[model samples]
Target: MSTPSYHPAAVALQAVLALANETEREVADRLGLNLTDYRALSTLSQSGPMTVGNLAVKLGATAATTTAIVSRLQSRGYAERLRGEGDRRHVHVSATAAASRDIMNLMRPLMDATNRHLESLPAAQQDAVAGFLHTARHLMQNHLNTLSTKDTA
Candidate 1:
């Protein structure tokens, strides 16, 4: 067997992702939500109201599963389904005000601390960090696209 070498940046990125997942888990726990529900609520809050189908796609969940998730959210007073004004059959899922408030309250401390850390860096270092993260996000999206294409093909 051959040993495989890993890049330091790749290792660091993996650590960052693990930390993010842990944070998300803690947030979800405090909200009395499962991870999926927390993620769905977060998506709705950030993206505004969207069709259940669109939300399913974003969440990489089946339509039926998405409907169930929405139901759970609605029951918890974290989300609601709204009918389109013009189309009676069309419905959108939205995060309730309470969901946004609770999620923000849970996250504000972390957000403030992260912002402070970024602000403490020199301007050039701040820009460099921002640029690195932006590029990394783009690269990850591209990789996801490639994998999706391969799966479909």
Candidate 2:
């Protein structure tokens, strides 16, 4: 077989994703959380309160699994469950203030480091990087939507 050529952009993108995943895993470890719990915490922190079904969608977990995760978080005092006003059966999960603070403390250093690195780049390069990330995010979201639709079908 002939040797295959690799695109620089593809390699760089893969490296970036791998680095991000590794960093997240390290942060999760430092927080004494598994990857799934960490991801659920992240979603709650970013999205405020959401129903279990919504959180399940966000976490790509089933309702039963998300409930167990929420239970664990509640036991740890990291999350709270709120009952809906009109419908007592409807429940929403939110990250507690302590959880938010802890997550911020854990992530601030990484955010600052990334910001410093971005600052070292030229303004034009920084803008290009931002644009590329925005585009990549949208493309990935579209692909995820397609996959979800296919799964449902």
The alpha-carbon RMSD values of the candidates against the true structure, listed in the order shown, are: 1.7, 2.3
| Best candidate (score: TM-score) | 1
Candidate 2 C-alpha lDDT tens digits along 94-130: 9999998999998898889989999999999999999
Q: List the residue pairs that clash in candidate 1.
A: none
Q: lDDT of each model, Cα atoms only?
A: 0.95, 0.92
**Candidate 1 on 1-153: residue-level lDDT in tens?**
997889998889989989999999999999999999999999999999999999999998999999999999999999999999999899999999989999999899989999999999999999999999999999999999999889989
State, as a TM-score between 0 and 1, how close model 2 is to the true structure.
Answer: 0.85
Error of model 1, residue 43, in angstroms: 0.8
Name the lDDT of candidate 2: 0.92
Candidate 2 stretches greater than 4 Å from native: 2-4, 120-122, 146-153
TM-score of each: 0.90, 0.85
